[model samples]
Target: MFQHSRLTEFLLGLFAATSILAPSAAHALGGDGDKVVARVVTFGGACEKCDLSGRRMSGAQILGANFSGAALVGSDMRSVRVLGANFSGADLSRADLTDSEMIGSNFSNANLSNARLRGVQARGVAFSSAIMVKADLRDTEAQGANFSRADLSSAQFNDTSLQGAVLSRVDGRGASFRDAALQGANLSSGRFDRAIFVDASMDGAVLNGGQFDGADFRDASLHRAALFGADLSGARNLDQDQINHACSDASTRLPKGLVPRTCRGVTPHWSPKAPPAPPAPPAPPRP
Candidate 1:
């Protein structure tokens, strides 16, 4: 039963708080202002949890901000400069973070299930043991990010780049990776049951001792990818051309196909954007 004046003030404050953009490194930012906290306390921080859902705090500088264990469910923190921000055990489920920068942010043990993070630059962020089930991460950049022991079931990564990201011991059942680039990504001991990888680029990625039950690898590149002792049983649509391109070994068992001889080492897969061919000489068109 908030009055009209209260609602107007609350909306104004919320809008003012969620409009800051951050940087692209894992370091604490420099901004000592109480602008964001005051806004949060007014609108959403009722008793225990803050309901800053869809608050457009894009590109705000909130370095060293202690949000550890804070409930930021469905917050819109796009392009925020929050280096070394402590978000440990925070609940950021279903948050919208398009084009945001969350470098060096600590989301350890956070619940980010159903979060929409298209085109976010989250390099070097820590999400150890975090749960990101059904998260939408299309066209995002999460290089050097750590997701060790995270639960990522049904996560989508369309056209995303995760070069050198660590996702060891992850639960990624029914995940989709259409046109994603995962070069040098580490996914050892991950559960890929029913995961879809349509047109994914996994060059030099690590998948040691993983579970790939009901996984789809249509047009996926795995060049130099390691899958030592990985269980690829029930993996479908892994054709010979794709196998030869990505270097699979004796461990990669298809439904019923001859073990490839040319693929002893890791496979030969292409990256998302291959080096452009040398530009042809400027042609002098004669009429």
Candidate 2:
């Protein structure tokens, strides 16, 4: 699901559109010149289809750099490290990447609309089919990230952890995910219209066929969550004893007072919630 390989040894042959290398005027930064010639450089060469639009490269390191199909509009890259960088099909619109480390970075089909990625570490990042509309990713850790079919409309992810993340078929309309952890996340067929899972944990999350129109699961936990054929029409602070404590079936589709859990494949009652409070540290370097 993460393509863009031109026989990657720093993407061999580098596919044309070169001639934007104008570094020396005491190592210039703006005007897209410097091409990261080591004021803080760690880039080991190869920049396929590079333009590096509006480059500044704050705190540049560029670990294992390749930058496949690069443009990087409005680039600043605050606190950049870019660990295992590939940036597949990169554009990075309005990029800042605040407090970036970007572990195992690929960013498959990367666009990163309105990118900031606050407190970014991005552990095991792939971001398959990534666009990341309105990306901020506040307090990001991105544990076990994949983000399959990603669009992430109005993305914020306040206090994000994303543990064991896959996020299959993600669209995430009006996404917020406040106090997010997403324990054992898979989030199959996700759309999440008007999404805002306040105090979120999503324990043992799977969320099969998720769509949750007007979603706002206040004080959200969802212990041992599954929600087979999940729809949750007009979901807002979901009640009915939190869908009878989790693991739904009978083709789960609730909204008005709820009552549909008769598929009895039960065995998911651990109720463990108190672990998501460690992500608010790394946003201090952009001076």
Candidate 3:
């Protein structure tokens, strides 16, 4: 009878110890730095306008967290998973988001100026009307993401894949897009003055009614792209054949030696098409 009582007491002590250590272990995941750890990252707590500046948030899971109007300047968010998190109107200037997964994340009207989004996989993310001036999006895959009306002046998009992205009416003055793929993207009515498109592929993209004054398209491919009513006056590095292959309208202003009749005869369509066959395999080499 005495032994049974002792065993019960020991079990009670062990339970008490485990309960005491569990909360500490959970809290340790949020970092014990100088920044306030009012909320844990794993469980996710509401901290709107939270001062998360200079915090080390690498590989942290902050799903559905409300960080609207939060100050996240210079934060290291590399490889972090922030699925469905709300960052509307948040200040993320100079933040490093390399390889981060922000699927379906909301960055609407947020200030992401000078942020580094290299290698980020942000499929279906919404960045509508966000301020992303001078941001670097090198090698980022943000397919079907929305950036409509966003201010992307002086941004760099080297080797980025923005297939089917919504970039309608975006202000992209002086932006550089080296070898970037924007297939089937919506670029309607946007301002792209002085933008560089070196070796970029924008096949089947809709650029209707956009302002492309002085934009450079050196070695860029626009096969089957719809430029209906787009203003390409004074656009550099473009040839007659490149404008002929694309669909434009009477309102589309072309460079010198390239007539508007090439694109003005037909309506613009935004769909991929197979290349022409090689003359029936050259008649089977004449047998």
Candidate 4:
């Protein structure tokens, strides 16, 4: 009888312990079986060519890290702070980076196609030569960022702020910049056929030698914008008043009956304001 009682007590204790530890173990392993949880919270140092595809790294801090050529496709990296990180040549396609802060980061030649970057703060970041086709960048603040020669075809930049941004030679065919702030941004020598710029503020923007065939410019402000050598003959919704506000030269191809004016002493209508503060960092995960 005593032996049986002892055996029963041991089994009961074992069951209790297992029940207590099971939940914690599952939580540590990321309760969901579909997503792989990241082992570390903070990422730094060089992790070049690392494959981190489909990892759940929301709110991660990746300061000064070198993740060049890494694969981060389909990762959930929302609200991540990646200051000064080098992500050049990385494949971040279909990744969710909404409300993230990536100031001064280098993403040159990276593949960010179909990525979600809404509300991202990317001041001074370099996205030159990156393939961003069909990427969603609505409400993004990218002042002074370099996007020169990027493939931004069919991308969404509605209500985005690209003040002083370098977008020279970008392939922006079928891209939308509706209500965007592109003051002093450089779109020189780029292809923007069928692109939408409705109600956009493009004051002082340089569009020299760019293609704007079939592009929409309805209610867009072009105060002091440079249109020298730009092809706007096939553009839609461009009125005489808007043309008078812009600086155009003889090389600028405009719609019939619109005269080109020189850019001398033109007063800009839009005033520049300081960018808004970045969003707060995400809270730490539960222990």
Name the candidate that leads on TM-score.
Answer: 4
Sorting all predicted structures by lDDT, with the top scorer first, yields 4, 3, 2, 1
Q: Which structure is stronger by lDDT: 3 or 4? A: 4
Using TM-score as the measure, name the better of candidate 2 and candidate 3.
3
> Per-residue CA lDDT of candidate 4, range 1-287, in tens?
12333423433343344335555675786663222233234545555676768766676677666778888999888888887778999999999999999986889999999999999998778999999999999999888888999999999999999988889999999999999999989999999999999999999898999999999999999989999999999999999899998999899999888888887875353343443443333333233
Whole-model lDDT values for every prediction: 0.68, 0.74, 0.75, 0.83
Instruction: Give the Cα error of residue 69 in candidate 2, in Å.
Output: 32
- lDDT digits (tens) for residues 77-153 of candidate 2: 78787776688888988899898787776888889888888998887688888898988989998877889888998
Best by lDDT: 4
TM-score of 1: 0.72
Backbone clash pairs for candidate 3 read none
Please, what are the lDDT tens digits per residue for candidate 1 over residues 1-287? 33334434554575664344343221243342233433233221111233445565554555544456666777766656555556788788987767766766778898899987888877778888998999888888887778889998999878888777888999989988778888888888999999987788887788778888888888888777776667776787777666554545676555567354344543433233321222222222233
lDDT tens per residue, model 3, 53-78: 76666666665666788888988777
Q: Is candidate 2 or candidate 4 better by TM-score?
A: 4
Tell me each candidate's TM-score. Answer: 0.72, 0.34, 0.77, 0.81
